[model samples]
Target: MQSGLALLLIGIQLVYAGKHSLQYFYTATSGLPNFPQFVSVGLVDEQPFTYYDSNIRRETPRQDWMAKSEGEDYWEQQTQTLTGTEQSFKNNINVAKERFNQTGGVHINQVMYGCSWDEETGDVDGFDEHGYDGEDFFSLDLKNLRYISTVPEAHITLVKVNNNKALLEQKKQYRTQECIEWLKKYLQYGKSTLERKVSPEVSLLQKSPSSPVTCHATGFYPKEVTISWQKNKQDHDEDVDLGELVVNEDGTFQKTSTLSVKPDDWKMNVYECVVEHKSRTIRSILTEDKIKTNYAPVPIGIIVGVVAVVLLLVIIAVAGYKVYQKNKGFNPVNASDDGSNSSAHSDPKA
Candidate 1:
């Protein structure tokens, strides 16, 4: 009996494991000069693979595998679908402006929707939500088959969205069924690129002798990694700051963990930074020889000039949307016809 129970529990655990996801983000902006009026991005496993904007007026693949796998017909269809969505979102921004009683000065409307599939158990789930001006607008409650309004202004939208029973059913079916199918197809096409593993390059950095020692890892694929510190062969967590994972332009990820210790204490005790990713483990000893510092005998003028250039580039990147924010929302807009027109789908071929 115990064996049977253990088997059942293992099966249950397997049902929720090995999950993969596909997500889409749509954004529309008004009063933002010299920027695309509409933008849409598609991601698999949190890595963006496809992008479209009003300025480009075409669907382009961000990953080389995607471009190689999909043909011109697929790109053309995707472009057409997103172009229609772009116009719908533009109109939505206008309607949202009316609701907010604003003539307008830089407003945004954003929508995020996606589905997740458990490969081990064939279980699937999905979500759809919208935001306006960096705040939640409304979302679909798939379990209850209802619309949830996050703010008072979204109540009307919620009612209008929920009133269409047929559309609601269609949306649910698409998310739970069609979406998962497309995700699987994409996984197959990009398996080589998506499933490949690349180990990280580890380094220790310090700004000055008095500063905390930082263990940095970069160029790692799959994004699942852990960085920890050990003191004298024992786990050390106190006074340690873990940085958020950042994706490099090349699609690999980077992370950092900083450990604070007095000079005398670290010199006396053996300290190490351990990083674990996939089936590999890396250990870096914290020593004066391993620490790279910016306080070297560099000219102050050169340092100041480099810092200024970096700051200017950062500002321009932020203004130009070179780095997309997942939670960003623009001004609210009332969607038409259950907002179905705003949704984009994968090519029906194959």
Candidate 2:
């Protein structure tokens, strides 16, 4: 429910007023403690654009940038739309801030947004997340940005789980009603945004000089891509680490898969990284250019050396204790010749 709603919301939200493809996005984040700031620079279809913030601020585009606009005068008119939204949601953030009375915490807030289309499905999808101090206050579905579920509220986590009086139902109805038309409009407008895209650029990254080789792919669109390592054209799933799709600074995505190559196996350069996606299928060979060879050897040598040293010391200490007992004319067990134990008071010289 959470993931689906998020996907639907953002896919529909940005395409409002018939905006097409997402060229890219610019984001502002807070780094300092207790900093109160969030903003986004959304470039849509290269014409109808969104330059807005949580403080109810937005920008009006000049007439020359039509590749970014959809209908007539959309950018100038977006100010009122965006400002109204900011005003509506700003109160919630303020309330959350006020309730966070503890001082030791950093008191941070962040807003993230994304617009992406699935290549094979030709379906537009989006995601938005707003949080305070790393805890999610709410998540917005791009297709229905206004349809925030009360589930993610930090102050009232139980409001969603313990919902008995159908309060959650009421909220869902309100959100759905408010954004249904917008979702429809977004789907209709964004269907044509980059039906297909270029194949991802691929490479391999090593976590440590001696660890596994990570197969990395970047600059691909529609989000779905698969990466596999092969030797002699056969799958190499042993000790492989697969990563999820990671969005880049650009609208494209990146992903990785790590293949553990021991020192004995690392000499073979025939290892290939194969990436499959709707746009295209490509393979990158693990050559000296693709992989770095700073791999550190396993510490087995050091461990064996330490163990050998410890055992040698233990043996020498035992031998010295026996020698000292013999020199002092004392039996280590302190027993008599007839197999009876001697008393503690027995003289060592005797």
Candidate 3:
């Protein structure tokens, strides 16, 4: 199963233009402390709309639009479906443990399935894959309607799924047809939020006079964006490092691109960072005065006060980090012999 960290990385990399997707990630874990045994998360356009976990034993809406648009009957049905899925994942974890000859220690089973649609080109693609302990186990090939095993240990699952022609047909139909229709409906319901575009707040930052200057953009909608550097009014790529696109707590996105240059070099050239998103283009010039930094000198008394504040904040941050470490990793659900029913389509409203 893909670890929680791997799943998060996948989410970060799914940015595309004029493309929308609906994905479901189900995880089951064993021998984890202070975490759910099973968990399921559903995302539309990379925004989480629904969440379910063994501790809750019920599915809940993670977004306002989801709660307002879906009725009680819808949530109830979803909860029941996930309840079954939770059990299925539990059994799956046990099956995996046996397959690996593991009687104890941490283990994870994960399944990620989704469909993407490109509005401009009307192209549709679907994927369904499983992982164990952060390694690929098996995946569905929608084109050929077959299960591809990634390892010899997964051959048993591949054969079992392939032999069930009816289940294979259901999987294909769900991924290609039903999944697309549901994605459309979700897009319509959450249009105001999902389709809205927000420009980024751009800034140039540096830690010190000798450090690289970073052009940072934050609080932007629709993760598709570009950040480029220019030197002397020309495109520049040398000594530039692009950071990963990350999701903000408010559902917006942030990214950074760093440019390394000698302080004297930057003083002699016209350097700028260009950010493009939707129909907007923003530029931040690399100037000493424009760069925000914490290296400036201050009065000794003020510095002492700042040090005290920093020490307090560091203490709190360390405590929070300890708690975070305890809860880190994939959340899980119970498993069953038949995993077909756990598909996102199990929600009747879909």
Candidate 4:
């Protein structure tokens, strides 16, 4: 009988020693007690089982079972199995969460964080890890066993909590790369359509003698558009600086460009807007100003009336002067009875 009691004590000491060793190892490796999660006894199976206090990294001993008359080796084996099974179950749960989240399912929160499982015979016998929303579910299979879960929304918080942080960070970088690729693809998709576009309006900002004419041309599909100015048939060498390209929410690109050159180019030259993207090339140009002339009826009437009044006054004055000359018959040089004597005197009229 004393031998039996001694064996019981020895078994208890062995289990305790093993538990402490595991606790120390977990703390050292993971920096926390539970490697993954802390499952409860209530949710575990009724079979000869073990409950790992994942938070404390320890096990809850069944007092009645340890007091049994089973030999010390037998009891010791049970203890090892219980602890080992708990550790193994935790490891599996971690792996399952990792693989499931990788699938990009919306229910990753429940699938990864705060998950639950039953450990029996050193394996996860049963597990339930999600709550259902209207549309989605979560489940996993290992060998012949499966654990199923249903959840409504992707539980982001839970994902952040139980997620493998190192791997999660890597996934963020991967997502960024994917987004960049998507943008490049979108830009490439409509390259041909954009290149074939023409803007309706051409606006010249300023024109001066010394400065380059700054022209702003607006057009559709600006991603494939190129703006430039031309003088006499030659491409202008002035710098063309493009402004920030704004993309609208509706998948169109809007952009602006400033072309600088001597202001004399604006007088009679053609400024061209060039668009070249994928499969097409299009251009719009504005050339020299077209002159216009207009004559009004009222201005013509006023000019004619002024000319007639000036001519009538001049005719009356000339007639009066001729009559005065005829009446003044006295010789302008001297007075004489006959015009013959006027040889010495000139006669105005005789």
The candidate maximizing lDDT is 3
C-alpha lDDT (0 to 100) for residue 3 of candidate 4? 20
Between candidates 1 and 2, the TM-score winner = 1
For candidate 1, report its TM-score: 0.78
Task: Write model 3 residue lDDT over 296-343, tens digit each, in one string.
Answer: 343223334533532221111000001111211211221222234233
Q: lDDT tens digits, residues 27-122, model 1?
A: 677888987887777778766688888888888998888888888877876776676667656766777787788895987766666688988888
Off by over 4 Å in 3: 1-15, 295-343, 346-350
TM-score pick, better of 1 and 4: 1
Off by over 4 Å in 2: 1-36, 40-49, 54-56, 59-68, 71-73, 84-91, 109-130, 137-192, 207-211, 268-270, 289-350
lDDT per residue as tens, model 4, 314-348: 11100000111222111111122212210011111
Q: Which stretches of candidate 4 lie over 4 Å from their true place?
A: 1-165, 168-212, 248-250, 268-271, 277-280, 286-350
Error of 3 at 104 (Å): 3.0
Q: What is the lDDT of residue 57 in candidate 4?
A: 42
Clashes of 1: 5
- Model 1's alpha-carbon lDDT is 0.66
Q: Which sections of candidate 1 miss by over 4 Å? A: 1-17, 295-343, 346-350
TM-score of the candidate numbered 4? 0.26
Q: Could you give candidate 2's per-residue lDDT for residues 1-350 as a string of tens digits?
A: 23312231122233222333342221222333332143333434322233455444654432233334355455444444344333323333344555565434333333333344443455555443444544444543334333344533342523322232343332233233322333334444544553347678776666466667767677787666878888878887877888744444344556778787773575564788899987889898876566645423432333244335322211110000011122211111121211111000110010
> Positional deviation of 260 in candidate 4, in angstroms?
2.6
